[model samples]
Target: MRNLWNLIVQYHIALVFLILQGIALTWFVGSHGYPRGKWVQRSLEWQGKWDQRMSQWDRLTELDDLNRELLAENATLRAELHTARRDGVQSTYQGAEVIRSTWNGASNPFVLNKGTAQGVKPGLGLLQNNRVVGRVVEVSENYALALPLINKSMEWSVRIGPTGPVARLVWEGGDVTRAMVYDVPRSASFAPGDSVVSSGFQGYFPSGLLIGKVADETPEFDGQFLTVPVTLAADFRAIRYVEIATVQGRMELDSLANSNGQQAP
Candidate 1:
C-alpha cells in the first residue's frame, strides 16, 4: 500500500496536467460555435456513412436469396413446358433438388427435398433434362425417395416410338448412360438410330416420355429376342434438379387398378 502511494505521488503532476488539458480542450470546443458545429457535423457524417453501408449489406443479402428463388422457378417452368409438350397428358410439375443420389450400384435411389407437403407422392414420375428419370417410390412430409431408371430393380414398359415393339427397360448392373431393353421381337425393324419412350401402359408415367434412343441392337444370350442397348436421355450421374410429374386423378386410378388386379384402362 505504501509503495502504491509512492507511485501515485510520483505520477500525480503528469496526471493533473492531463486532466487540466482535457478540461481546457472541452471548454474551448464547447464555448466556440465553430468547433462545436464541426464536432457534431463529423459525428453525423460518420453515422450517415455507417447507415449507408448497412443498407447496402441488407440489399446484397436480399439479392442472394432472390437469385436462388429465381433459379428454382426457372427449372420448374422449363420442366413443366417440356413435359406438357411431349407427354400430352393432364399433368403438372414441381421442382425439387436432389439431396442425395447414387448411380454406381445395382439398386440406386435418389432422395429429393420435396415430399407430401409439396404435393409429392408415390407413383409420381420424375424427369430431368426433358426425359424420364425415375418414379417416386416413397415419401415423407419434406422429402421423397426415388428409384432412378438406372437402378436394376426399376423396369418401365417402353416401346420404340413410331411403330416399334413393346419391351421392358432394364439396367444391366453397370453403365450410367446406357441400359437395355429385352423382349423386342427379333423380326422387329432394327434401325441404327431409333427412339424409345414410355408406353404409359403401366399407369406410372405418361406416354411419350422420352427414355432414350437405341444405341445398339444384338441378340440376347438365349437367342430368342433382341437385347436393344439404349442411351438414356436423362443424365442421372450429375443431376441437380428434377421435376415431379403428377398425373391427374392418380388416386382414383390407383384405387381402381388395385381393386381390379390390373392396370387402369
Candidate 2:
C-alpha cells in the first residue's frame, strides 16, 4: 500500500495533466451544439432500427396464423361449389383435413379427421379444391375411410367431355398421374384436352364436377368401347384438405335396396 502511494506521488504531476486534459476535452464537447446533436441522432437511429426489426417479427407471426385460417375457409368454399353443381340433389357439405392416405397400394384409401359425429358417412363423396377426390367407404365416431380415385377397385360414372355422354372411370394402377375412361362411345370425338366430369348416377357426387382431362385416346382390346387415358386433376401425394358432401337421396335409395334385397339399376 505504501509503495502504491509512492508511485502515485511520483506521477501526480502527470496525472493532474491527464485530468486537465480530460476536463478540457469534456468542456470542448459540451460547448459544441453539433456534437451533442450528433450523439442524440445516433441514439435515435439505433432505436429506429430496433423498432423496425421488432415490427417485422410481429408481422411474420401474424401472417402464419392468417395462412391457416385461409386454408380452412377454402375447404368450405369447395363444399359449397359441389352443392351448386346440381339443383335437385339435396346435400350437406363440411370441411376436413386428411389424417392418413396411401397411393402406392392396390386399394388406395384416405382417412380424414371427421366421421359420423361430423356428419361424415359411407357413400358421401370427398372433394378437394373443387375436384372429385374420393367416396367415403367406412366411418367411426371421429374418423372415416375414403376410397380414392387411384384405387384399383375405385370406379366412377364419368363423362368423356364436358357435355358428352357417360363413361366409366378407373385407374390403370401403374402411373399415379394417369387413369382410364372406359365405355366412351367411339362415335364421340374427344381429344387430349377435353374435360371429363361426373355423371351424378350415385346421387352422392353431383353431375358435371371435373375429374380430369383426356390425355390420350387408345383403342381398347375389346374394340367395342374406346379406352381413353386421363390425366388426374388432384395430385394424391400432395393432398392436405378435403370436404365431405352429404347427399339427400342416398338414404331413401339405401332403404329401397335393403327392402328388395337387390341393388339399384
> What lDDT does each candidate get?
0.73, 0.72
Tens digits of per-residue lDDT, candidate 2, 82-102, equal 467656665566777675667
Model 2 TM: 0.68
Please list the residue runs of candidate 1 whose C-alpha ends up more than 4 Å from where it truly belongs after superposition. Answer: 1-88, 217-223, 263-265
Predicted structure with the largest lDDT when compared to the true one:
1
TM match of model 1 to true structure: 0.66
Model number with the top TM-score? 2
Instruction: Give the TM-scores of the predictions, in the order they appear.
Output: 0.66, 0.68
